[model samples]
Target chain A: MNKTTKSNFITYGMVIAAYVIMQILVGTGSVSSLLKGLLVPLCIYVVLALSLNLTVGIMGELSLGHAGFMCVGAFSSAVFSVVTVDTITNVAVRFTLAIIIGAIVAAIFGIILGIPVLRLRGDYLAIVTLAFGEIVKNFINVVYLGIDKNGFHFSMKDSVSLNMEEGSKVIINGAQGITGTPKNATFTIGIVIILISLFVILNLINSRSGRAIMAIRDNRIAAESVGINITKYKLMAFTISASIAGVAGVLYAHNLSTLTALPKNFGYNMSIMILVFVVLGGIGNMRGSIIAAVLLTLLPELLRGLNDYRMLIYAIVLIVMMLFNWSPKAREFRDKYSLKRLFSKKNAQKEEA
Target chain B: MSFISYLINGISLGSIYALIALGYTMVYGIAKMLNFAHGDIIMIGGFTLFVVMNTLGLPPLVAVLIAIAICTALGVIIEKVAYKPLRQASPLAVLITAIGVSYLLQNVALLIFGANTKLFTSVVTVPAISLAEGQINISGETTVTIIASIIIMIGLMLFIKKSKAGQAMLAVSEDKGAAELMGINVNATITLTFAIGSALAAIAGALLCSAYPTLTPYTGAMPGIKAFVAAVFGGIGSIPGAFIGGILLGIIENLSKAYISSQMADAIVFAVLIVVLLVKPTGILGKKINEKV
Candidate 1:
């Protein structure tokens, strides 16, 4: 096998080993409840950072509405689960269907948002995506949806004059959001979803299509001259990135009993925070994104004892990490210590022998 | 509220948006960076004003000056420390750094001010004035906001038209390398642009707090984003476009809130932005850029 493929297998094995170790620790009652609660979130963030890297890092497009797609997935999946809970007695089946529905809805929205993105570039594209995110959040705040024996009912206005059975459930109550969602999500499920995301994205990156997307990112004009259909490739990466985010969202929604469309949860701030993870993890580096997402997620919680200084310390770390990663001296140091060089050196020595 | 009253209120709100949009557009024009922390600078200005007037019991005029000066310095420091190094970096890298700076400012403010809301007294407090036989009422704060915004606009226009420094700024924005070759001192001009933009943010903050009467560490964020939308709506790099865009955005936002669903107001505003962008990507007054192959 090639060196890169071998390295990829090593990384995947390491991740599986880590997951197994954590699960064993939890089973032995050695890990804290707080840490256990963080496990699923950590996985979700890894998925988000991974997906975002595909767009921001690999595809060379700046998307600021990743959280919006996550929101769409979360709400759509939550609604689906709520609607099916009565008929679909099997929890696993219901959740599987919900995940599929969420992925489809989010991918569709991704395409819709990605269409306008083709015409714009740079800051303008960023702003348009930002606008899309804001619009989604704002719309979620006012949209009321519910399912009953009377079938589906939705209205922007508060009064949803639907005649239903006495036991009808309100799926979404505007700003109050979707409540009593089935909490079937487990840490194991989260890890599996993240694995799926990594598998899809990693495989894509090594494929011929992936090379075309990267080629476009490296030089749009050059790629166009080579007859690479820019729009098709861009959409492929973007839609996939968004759908992966949707899976993460489904996992997130199921983890929570109640899901609200608060700004803190699904707003511009959330989008920016996810982007921060992708950027700080070393853009276009999947392993870096995973490492960054895991450590950064854990860092804030570990510093909870710092009380008021928690966020302050987090902010300082973000700035320092960015500077270190982007600084010229740091780049030189990284190049000198790169794993590729070490492997190549070993290969040359073997050849001489 | 009466239609005229809503119109007046929208105008006042629009003026505030215009003020903030000016800062955003100026920084974007000359520096070619979003300056994401521009919004946080507003919060700093508001807090500075609050501490000066409310705690130290300074005169309003002096308090305002101190706030403006502080924002101006903060702006320059941010440019030097965070932005200057990234000047030649990719737009994505620079944008991320800006976001980092923004987070730092916000978290620092949150650390100092705590999470609770603080009451902000109006900078302009005159007895209510009645117009059109009591059909329309204009508050003193609203009047001050409208008049001050107009004055600021006129003054800025004249400055850009007449002054050497203003001409330098214009020239630099037009073409940085060409301006540098002409001995325009691009660094100093960029620094000056940041200072001016930040000072405008301070004024906008003070006015916004007076109108809203409550301040939080996050008060500046929504307005900042809206003003950015205004900047883009008016053609990102155009000064007059920012002015008109801000005012138009304010009116649209307020009118939608009053007439349509209040909760959907933000959604409607963003939809308008999307439609406008689809129709006219360069914005109403933005110059079309041709990409060289």
Candidate 2:
């Protein structure tokens, strides 16, 4: 096998091995349950941050509504898992079906949203996506398919007919959130899914299509001159990124079991928080995004003991990180330890041998 | 009667949106970059007013002036720290940095203020005013919003039309490189632009807080997005267009919520934006220019 193929295999193998080891530890009761809970969310967020990096970092598109895609996945999977009684009989079947359904539903919404808005550039695209995100959240909150005596009935479809008199069924429960989702998401499952997502994205980034998308990000005009179809690639990035975000959403819903009643989690702030993770990790660097996502997610939990000052310390860290990058002294220090030379030295030694 | 009041309420709300949109349009006109944190500046202005009025026990007018002064300084600092260094960076870099600054300001506010709502009573209370139609009464607060917005709009127009600095601002907006060649301090001019934009945002915040006393750390996000929509709806860089667009958006949103379902109001507004963009990308009052090769 070629060296590149061998390295790719090794990376995948290592990731799978790490996941398996974590599972064994969790199963054996070696790791704390709190730590395990933290790992589940961290794994989901890594998928989210990395998926978002595909659009915002790699493709140079500013999509402010990624969480909306996640919402679609969460709701879709929640509804499907709740309705499907047979899948619960087998754990493997249930997991596979939920993921497949979540990814598919998210991809569909991604395409639907991407078609019109992807044509816009930069700030315009950002604003459009931001609006779309709000629209999705509100739509989910208000749109009721029917009313029944039992509760409110909600359908994923745009229109549904129901008898209005007996009792009202509000599908989304208005300000109230979806509840009673099957709690099948475990640390092992979350880690496996995250690893699979990372593998897919990494593979895509190294491929020719990925290069074309990155080229478009660097300079749309140049990429277009080189015969790249900008619209197609942008749509591709949006759809794929959105689908992965959907997977994260499904994992989140199942893990939490009870979704928050408030629209608090699906707002612009959440989107911005995810974007911060991407930026903090260093955009366009998958490893950076993964590390940043994990660290930032854990940082607050780690500092929970600090009580009122937890958020204060968190804000300080964020500000200091931004200021440090912008400071000239930091730049000089960064230049001294440039990774380019370090990697090049190893390559040169291998060539000499 | 309550529904009619809500209609009037929507119009007054739209005026505040118009006020904020002016700053967005003016900055975008000159810099060609959306000041993503413009809304947070408004939030800061509101908090400044709260501190001045509530904590310091200053009179409303004096407190407003203090708030404006602080916001103007904050605006200038933001421009210098976050934007000036990246003036020539790719649009994406500037955009990211703007978002960073936005988050920085928000988290700072959250850290300092806590997440609970803050009450600014000075802006919220006013006796109701009777209209000519005895059945149609208007709140004194709504009247103040309408009058204040008009006065501010006219004052800005006169300043842009007659003042030297305003003329220079217009020139810079027209052609930055050319204006610089003619001996304008582009950097200082840009700072002034941010300061003016921020001051207007402060006023809008103060007025909005009068109408709605509840202020949270995240209060700015939706208003900021709405103001941005107003800017885009009117024309990204058109000052007058932003004012008109903001009012129109406010009216449309309010009326739709009152006449139809409130839940669909957001969707309707976005649908309108999408249609406007498809029909006229440059916006209602914006001028279209061919992209440079």
**Local accuracy of candidate 1 as per-residue lDDT tens digits, B1-293:** 49889989999999999999999999999999888888889999999999999999998888999999999999999998888766677777777777778888888889898889999988886777899889899998889999999999989889988999999999999999999999999999999999999999999989999899888888888888889989999999898999999999999999999999888888888898888898999888999877678
Task: Give the candidate number with the greatest lDDT.
Answer: 1
On a 0 to 100 scale, what is the lDDT of residue B254 in model 1? 90
lDDT by residue for model 1 over A28-111, one digit each (tens)?
A: 999999999999899889999999999999998788888898999999999998888888999989999998998999999999
Candidate 1: Cα lDDT at B18: 96
* Candidate 1 error regions (>4 Å): A159-165, A325-353
Model 1: reference contacts kept, as a fraction: 0.48
TM-score to native of every candidate shown:
0.95, 0.90
True contacts kept of each: 0.48, 0.25
How much is A194 displaced in model 1, in angstroms?
0.9
List, for all models, the DockQ compared with the true complex.
0.56, 0.40
Q: State the iRMSD of every prediction, in order shown.
A: 2.0, 3.3
**Model 1 vs. true fold: TM:** 0.95
Docking class of 2: acceptable
